[model samples]
Target: MQGPVVTARSARPTVMTDGARRHLFNDRTVARYRHSLSEGVDRVAERISGADRPFTGMSPQRLAPEIAAIDLDQPLGDPSAALDELETVYLRDAVYFHHPRYLAHLNCPVVIPALLGEAVLSAVNSSLDTWDQSAGGTLIERRLIDWTAGRIGFGVDADGVFTSGGSQSNLQALLLAREEALTAAPAGSQLPSDRTELLPKLRIFASAAGHFSVQKSAKLLGLAPDAVITVETGADRRMRPEALERELARCRREGLPVMAVVATAGTTDFGTIDPLPAIADLCEQAGAWFHVDAAYGCGLLVSPTRRHLLEGIERARSVTVDYHKSFFQPVSSSALIVADAASLRHATYHADYLNPARMVEQRIPNQVDKSLQTTRRFDALKLWLTLRIMGADAVGALFDEVVDRAAAAHDLLAADPRFEVVTRSHLSTVVFRYLPAAGQDHERADGANLYAREALAASGEAVVAGTKVDGRHYLKFTLLNPETTLADIAQVLDLLAAHAEHHLAADERRLVRR
Candidate 1:
C-alpha cells in the first residue's frame, strides 16, 4: 500500500473542460505581450519624444546573458512585466528617428496612421501567400500597387509587389532582369556567362553617384562586381548622358553586351537625380533593360510640384520605391513595380502541393505568384491605410516641407561666415561644414571640422552624420523630420563650429610652440 501511494505534483497549465473555445494559439501570453507593447509605445511617445538624445542603443543579444537560462516556452510574467522589460531593453535602444535633431541618415519619422495599421496587421498575422489566406488583404495590397503605378504614369497594366525596403526591392528588380535575360535567350541554352569572355562584355551601367546596391546586384546576379561600370557624373552628380553614351560605346567596342542601364532618381550622398528621360532614351536605343533606383525620390510621383524631377520614370522597365522614406511609413515599407507584369513570368515557379492551380481559378493576385517572398507580411496595410487616411496631397505636402527645410538650412549656413553650405539642399539632405574663422587655415580647419562631426556623434547629445565626396570629407545633414525647425539645425551647426574652433586653435598653438 505504501509503495503504491503517489507523491504530490506541481500545478499544470489550465485545460478548459466546458470549453466554449479552445485556444489553438498562445492567446493569453500573446495578449499580455500586446498590452505591454501599447504601454511602452505610450511611454516612449510621452518621455522620449521631447528628449534630445541621439539614440538609445540596446540589443537583444546583449540580454542573452541575463535571460538565457529561463525557459521561454513557459509564459513570461503577465503583460505588465513584459512591457516594462520591452521598454527598458528594446524600445529605448532605438534611435528616435522622429526627433528633429536626428539628421543621421535616410531613417525618418513614423507616421501615426501607418503605425496604427502596423499594429492591426501584426495582430492579424495576415499572410499574403494566396488570395484564400489574404482575402481583403490581397485586394488592399493590389490597390496600393495600382495607386503607385498610376502616380508614376505606368501603363494601365503595370504590376508590383510590396517589399521590406529599398535594398530588397533593388535585389528583386535585378533578379527579374537576370531572369529576363535567361528566358529571352534560345531554348536549351545555358546561363549567360558572367565573364567578359563567354558572355564577355556583359555590362551593368550606373552613375558613379548611384548606390552600391547596383554593383552588389550585379555580383549577386553572377555578373562580377567588375561588370558594374561606373559612368562619370557632371559637377551636379547627375550622370552626364554624353559620358554614359561614351561608356556604352567603349563597352561595345570591347565586345561587352550591355545588360541593363541602372539610373538613380535620388543619389544617396548628394540627393542628385540623374536625367532619367535622357537615360531612358539611351537604354531604349541600346535595347538594354532599364531600371531606376528611385528609392529616395519616387515619392515625387505624388508631388504635383516636384513630379518634374522624374520626367521619364514611367519609361523604366522596373522601379524601386521605399514608402518608409517619403510616405512616413515605418521602416520596411518598399515596393518593386514593373511596367510589364508578364516579365515576371520569368520568376514564376510551379508547385503541386502548395499552390497548385489545377482545380481553382486564380484571382487578380495570388501575391506568391509575383513576389520574391511567399509568406509575406501585410506591409501593404500601413501604406494603404496611410494613403487612405491622408491621401496623396498630404504626403506630397510633407515632402515639400522637407524640401523647404533643406533650403532654409542651406541659406542659413551659406550666409554665416563661420559655416559653409558645401552643397545646396538636394531633396532633404545638405552637405556642409564649419568654415574656419578668417585667418584660420582652410585646410587645417577642414580637417578639424571633420573631426568635430565625429566628436559630436560621440558626445551623444546630438548627432549629425559625416561622409566624403570628391575625396574631401564633409558633414552631412539629412533632414527627414517635419517637426524639425531652423533653430534646431542652427544649434547643431553652432555646436559643430565651436567644437572645430576649439580643436583647430589648439592645433595652431601646438604648432607655434613647436
Candidate 2:
C-alpha cells in the first residue's frame, strides 16, 4: 500500500490551523520572510522620498487616540494589512532623522550598511550573553571593542562590552569606579569595613555642563544626594580645571574619597570638550578613576582632521562611545571600554546554569560577565558591518564635513544682527538665540526664543533643540546629517527670526490691550 502524497497545498492547512507557524522564520518560510522585509523596505523608502521635512509636528493628543483604537489581541493576520495600519498610526507622523533638517538632538542619520546589519541581527535573534548562544557574535563584538580601544590609543590590555547607549555605559563605568574606590581605600583613615557605609562619602566630580546621567547614576548606585559634585565650567563651556582642582582639594580635606572624575568630550548643549589632559592630571593626583563620556564626540576618534580634539581621551581609565551618535550606526550602539581588562570583573556574576566558574576555568567567553545586561542585543554587528563597507576614513570624512558645517553655521549666526551666537563648539553643535530688537528686555527675548522653538516645530519646516544658557533660553542646532547644507541652516535661521519677531509683536499687542 502506498501512502497518500503530501503536497505543498496540504501543508498550508496545517500551518493555518497552527495560526502563527507559517510566520516562524525557518527554511520553509525563507521566501515569506524575504517578501515581508522587501515590502517593509519599500514602504520606508517611499515615505522617505515623499517627506519634505524632518517632522510632521504631530502631537500626542492627536495621535494617541488612533493608537489606542487598535486592538492588539486581534491579529490582522496578513502582513500587508498590518503594514497599512502602521502607515496611519506610525509611518505618517514618524520623525524622519535621515532628513537633512533634523537638527534637534544627537540622533544621526543611519548608514545603509548598518541598516543591513540591523536586519540580519534582528532575524538571527542571537542573545550576546554566552558563547553558546552567540558564538561568532561574541567574538565579533570583542573585536569591535578592541578596534575602538585602539582608536582611542589604548594598549593591548583594553576590553569592553556593547551597551544600549551612553547612560548605561556611564552607569557601568561608575559602578566599576565605585568598587575600585571601596576596595582600594587606605588602611585606617575613617574608611569603614562596610562598603555601604562608605558610599555616602564617595564623591564623583563632573563639569556643570556634563550629562545629567552622572547624578542619575550616583542615585542608582545608592550614593548620597550630593555625591555628584558639579565643577563650574569656563566661558567656553568646558570644565574649568582650576575649579576642579579646588573641588578635589576640598573633598580631600573633608576625607571624601573621590570615586571618579568624569570629563565630557562633547557636552549636550554646548558641544564643548572638557580639557582632558588637565583633568586627567587632576584625576591621577587624586588617585581617582578617570572616565570620559565621549557619547557625542566619539566620532573624533575616527575623524581625519578633528582627531586632535579628543587628545586626552586615551588617558581615561574608562571611556564611553556611542557609535549611533558619531559613527552613523542605528540606535542602541554604544560601548564602555576600559584601559585595564580586569576592571570589568566588577560587573561579573557567575550563574550556575549559565556562565559558571567552571566555564571561566575552561576559558569560555561570556559577554554577560562584563555587561550590566544579561540578555543583550548584538549591536556590535552594526558597527562591524558599517566599518567593513564604508571604511573608517569614509565615516571620518562624513563627521568632518558636519564639523566644518557647524563652524560655518556659527559664523553665519555671528554675522547676523538678528541673532546672538554663544561660544563656538569644538564638535558639531551651534547654540544661539534670536535677538528680537535693541529695546527688547531679557524676559521678552527669552519668551521670543522659547516661542520660536515651539512654533518652528509646529510649522514642521525644521526641528531644532532648546536649552537654557546662563538662565536664558537658547536654540541649539546639532549638525549630524552630512547632507545638511549652509543654505538649509540659513533658511532655518530666517524662519526662526521671523517666528520670534511675530511672537514679540503679539506680546506687545497683548500688553497694550492690558
Candidate 3:
C-alpha cells in the first residue's frame, strides 16, 4: 500500500483539446507570447549592436555541418528556448544590413516606424484582399496608393494596387499593357483568338541596363524570349531616346506591336534615370503603353530638393515604385500605378464567394479586383506608418543624405588611382573595380577585382556587390545606408585594395610555379 502511494505531478500538454485554439483567447498565453517576442526583438537588437562585422561569412561547406545538427522537425515547447536556438542557427551568421559596412545590393536599413507597423499588422493578421477580411486595411491601402499617385502627378483617374515588390508590380503592369494592346488592335489585323498566336507579335522595349524583370515578365506572360527589345543606352548608361525611337520604328515595320516602352527611373547597376520625357513623347506618338520602372528612383517623389529628377513620370501609363527600396520602409512594399484606373479592369476576376460584381456595384472596395494577389499582406501599412511619423519630407531628406553620400563616395573612388570608378552616381550606388598596375592585362585586373570582392566578403569586414560591366568584372558599392560615411568608404576601399594586392601576389606566385 505504501509503495503504491503516488506523488503529485505537473500536467502534460493534452492532445484531447485544440492546442492551437486554446492559446487564442487566453490572456495568459498571449502575454507569454508577447514576452517571448519582446525578448526575441531585444536579443536581435543587442546582437546587431554588438556585432563587429556586417556578416560572418560561413561557406556552405562549413555551414552544412552546423545546419545539419539542427533538428527542425522537433519543437522546443517554449518560445524563448526556440528563439535562443534560432539566434545560434540564424541570427548569429545573419548579414546585418543596418551595419555601415554592408554595401551590397539594394537592401536598406528599415525605419523604426515601419517596424512598428509590421508588428501591428502581423498581430492583426489583415488579409488585404477584401473588405470583409481586412476592413479598414483595404481603405488604408487605397489611401496610400492614391497618395503615391498624387505624388507622381497622375490624373484624377489614376489608380494603383499594392504588390509584393517591384517584380510583381512590373508583371501586373505588363499584363495590363498586354490586354490594352489586344483591345486596341485594328479591326482586321492579326488579333488572335488563341493565346499562343499572340506571343510572337507582342514586343516590349526596355534599356539594356533596365532591370531583368522586363524580360522575365515577357517570358512569364507567354511572350517569346526575344520579345524584349533592348534599347541602347548612352555613355551615362541612361536609355537613349533616339535608339528607342528607331527600335519602335523597326517593330512597326516588322508588323510587331510594341506592347510597352519601359523607361527606367532608376537602372539597377548604374542608378541611371532614362530620358523619360523624350521616351514618353515617343511612346505617345507610337501609340505604345509607357511604363516607367521607378522602383529605385521613386524616392525622388518625396525628395524636396531633388523632385525635379522625375519630371515626366506623370505621363507614364503605368509606373512601378518600390517603397522597400527608396522609401526606407521594410520589405514587401511596392505599388503599380496607372494613369488610367480603367486599365486595372483587365486584372479583375470576380469570385462568387469573394469579390463579386455585385459588391463592386454596391461600392464595397475589394482590393482583389485590381490586385494579382488574393491573400495579400497589408504591406501598405509599413509605408503609411513611415509617412505618418517621419513625414514625407523627412523620408526624402534621408534619401537625399544617402544620394549625397553616393556622390562623395564616387569622388573618393574617382580620385583614388588604385580603383577605376564609373560615371558619377545618379542615385545611391557607386560601381567601381580594383585597378591593378597600369601594365596588367584586363583579365588580370578582372581577376584581382573579383578575388578582392570575395576576400572582402569572406573577411566579413565589408560586404560589396559585383557585376559584369561590358563583360568585365566590376565591384560595386551600393550605398543605401545613410549612416555609412566617407571614412567608412575609405576603410572599405583600403581593405579592398589589400585583398586585391594579396590576390595579385598569389597570381604572380602561381605563374612563378608554372
Candidate number of the best TM-score: 2
lDDT of each: 0.79, 0.94, 0.90
At residue 212, give the lDDT of candidate 2: 96
Query: Which is the better candidate, 1 or 3, if ranked by TM-score?
Result: 3
Q: Which stretches of model 3 miss by more than 4 angstroms?
A: 1-28, 188-196
How high is each candidate's TM-score?
Answer: 0.87, 0.96, 0.95
In candidate 1, which residue ranges exceed 4 Å CA deviation?
Answer: 1-34, 56-76, 183-200, 357-364, 438-441, 509-514
Tens-digit lDDT track of model 3 for 3-121: 56444432444463546555563465787668767898999889978989899986778877887997887767677788788887788889998999999899999999999999989
Tens digits of per-residue lDDT, candidate 2, 1-514, equal 9999989988566645677788899999999999999999999999999999888989999999999999999899899999999999999999999998889999999999999999999999999999999999999999999999999999999999999999999999999999999899888777776888888899999999999999999999999999999999989999999999999999989989999999999999999999999999999999999999999999999998889999989999999999999999999899999999999999999999899999998999889999999998999999999899999999999999999999999999999999999999999999999887888676799999999999999888899999999998999999999999999999999999999999999999999999
Residues 243-330 of candidate 1: C-alpha lDDT, one tens digit per residue: 9999888876775667788999888787778999999999988778899999998778888588888889989999999988888888
Arranged by lDDT with the best first, the candidates are 2, 3, 1
